[model samples]
Target chain A: MNTSKPAAGKAPAGGGRETARRARTRERLLDAAYRQFCEHGINGTSIEAITDDAGFTRGAFYSNFASKEELFLALTERENRARLETLRDRFDEVVAPLGRVAGKPDPELIEGAIADILAVQPDNRQWCLLNSEFKLLAMREPQVAPRFLESVRTFQQELAAMVDTALASVGLRFSVDSGHLTRLLLDHFESAMQEAILAGAEDAERAVRDNVMRTLPSLVHSLTEVRPPGS
Target chain B: MNTSKPAAGKAPAGGGRETARRARTRERLLDAAYRQFCEHGINGTSIEAITDDAGFTRGAFYSNFASKEELFLALTERENRARLETLRDRFDEVVAPLGRVAGKPDPELIEGAIADILAVQPDNRQWCLLNSEFKLLAMREPQVAPRFLESVRTFQQELAAMVDTALASVGLRFSVDSGHLTRLLLDHFESAMQEAILAGAEDAERAVRDNVMRTLPSLVHSLTEVRPPGS
Candidate 1:
């Protein structure tokens, strides 16, 4: 209710320049708001805090985002999308060995994906700060919680699909419970991420990740056990 | 801090009766406090709300709990301990049938454990509520953050010890990263609990758990991979 309404401005030369400037201001506010929210939590954060961090006026904040809630929706969407792209790219970057290149996934590729998330994602302190604090912001504002969960679902589904495809191609699958394996893997990644976030390198997230790759061979073996007649 | 300090009073004639009554009062307050905290969060609920729920007065709240922070810490410890006991007892109850006696775990034992947690623990809304909101409280006052992390660590270590003993008895030992595996398994249980608590069985939580006993065989097989003799 006490939020700005979107405007449909005329498409004039000055209007175009104003649109571009507005986009920049929005991006700045988003970045600053993200950091603040991650640290201080969403409710704990204020419009003034966001504007101050971004070095903009409160007018500019309202001009860019309708409300604090809308900004968070944007942040959740943006973060998930960006992280997904990064994960896929990490997978695509590995240069598999000549022999293994024909079929098996390069360990480097998978390991890199795990390592990259461990290295670059906000530290556990920030994540705990976010999880403990800011997640409430998403749930309190009805427009955000389901959408946020949907985004997570989309990611999980896509990742599951990718793993499913990989296993199928390799003649490895599980009829007993392929779905369970995929969910467990997703859960594994999330748990590892959380531990990595909280304990930092003391958990040696990267090292455990290396072990994760070794587990994959056993995974492939299990798949062989449960795969369809010809899969 | 006006909380009953464990031995706050003693009735001369019938100390046993007074002690029993006081113990019951403490338990009632804890139960009410937990329900309130789960719904509202540590910061969201107050002494007033707790007392109202527990059928006590403001003065009674003071008599039982020294401070809001102290109550919160106590509630957290109580719930976590209870959860561990629940998980452990469930595992113990199922071990003979699932692992040793059955030659391997059947779906029943594992499914039973998962189901018990879902049924016995707090509802989805409450758990998800904590998942969403507790992080903020943890961040604002990190003095207890270590304790939270320690709780998780202790759980994982205890689980690892149980796993180690189980595998040893079976003449199958964890050669892979047992620590990570323990963390991973515990994480799955917790994640499933949260999912059950949150959106309510939206993902593969049930399906995955249904075959937890079955899938675990293949998993344990994989974990037996030999680590090189000595690097």
Candidate 2:
């Protein structure tokens, strides 16, 4: 174990390495907390439980996160960032190739992009539970609401930007504001996952995929129009 | 207060009156529990807190509900029934007149019906929080899942039936399964409410009304078509 000195004075030689190690530690703690929070709710789980599950001490947890709520927020940010990155990568791989060869946007290509993006997350049930828990907490706790809203808006804006770029690549743009479009799509996707989980569908993930695929592609098509020729 | 005898050995003259009184007690308890749960979550609250809030003794609570979870489920049923009743009443007041008129479903009537239904709930933030909390609990607890699922399906089916009747009365019907269409509209409505609450909009209720109104009428029109002459 690399027991590096604290950065109280001049920068250490291995500062970059130390920062990477701290990030890994934080990630591990978050993973453990996520599992515990899903199994037993946020209020039911304790900091000690998370630290023990992560194989760390209380000191390590405090150094990383000030409180359980903060850890929850950090987890939210991490999960949202990870999802956005996955979407960006998937969109690039599946839809970017068609960008160069531009005519009217192919329905098949748009459908494929929607399917691929929806398919990126397979563990819909766990995610739905965690996300719902966080949302409820934010709603009830006024102090947490602003920060939670910020994180949500950040994710929405980033996703909206990606959607705009992908659409522009194919000579199309949303008839409504891209941000509004993003919110609508996300609302549908989240609702689909929750419904699938509640219904105890044989394959919750596939249920979400099928439900979304049935309506979202057509909705997207209707919401998009050919870009104007001139700016 | 009627300290009525138990309905054990023989039927009493006041049996019906006693049953009505018991139902009133249950409703009172549920109303109190809903407020407490909204204020300090399901898990954060205790049985004592609920009974105290309802001005009932522990015995009264136990007589009415077996456990907190059971009370929570009862609250869910009561709220769902209340909302359905309100929607039914609102639809009757606003759209039933048009039901007798025989022409293509007026866009204005459809919009008005949608608006009235959405406007029926003024406390979106509280409902969103409580609903999300219960959903998370249901997702985490397997025993609660089946009952919760039943309540959800019951609501969806009843709402679908209403939608079918209303649309048919206006010489139209859902192109898709009425249940599926109901789910889509509900998903959008719930999402819009959550978003408005999270954004801390000046009027979260109005925001939900506006957001749902903007898209749902168009979506509904697209989803419905003229009914077959005989069928």
lDDT of 1 at A173: 48
Q: What C-alpha root-mean-square deviation, in Å, does candidate 1 show against the real structure? A: 8.1
True contacts kept of 1: 0.28
TM-score against truth, every candidate: 0.69, 0.82
Worst 10 residues of 1 chain B by lDDT: B222-231
Q: What range of 10 consecutive residues in model 1 chain A has the weakest lDDT sum? A: A91-100
Q: How does candidate 2 score on lDDT? A: 0.80
- DockQ each: 0.26, 0.38
Predicted candidate 1 versus true structure: per-residue lDDT over A1-231, tens digit per residue? 756544556466667667788888888988999889876767789999999999999898887789887787677667667766665554333212212434444445445444554455433345444543434555454555566567656766776666556455444444445565666777776555554444444544464465455544344333334244653
**Local accuracy of candidate 2 as per-residue lDDT tens digits, A1-231:** 979865575767668767888999999999999999987888889999999999999999999999898999999998899888888877767666446556556667678878877777757678788888888778767778788989988999999999888777766777666776677678778887887887778898999899888877766665567788763
Shares of reference contacts reproduced by the candidates, in order, are 0.28, 0.46
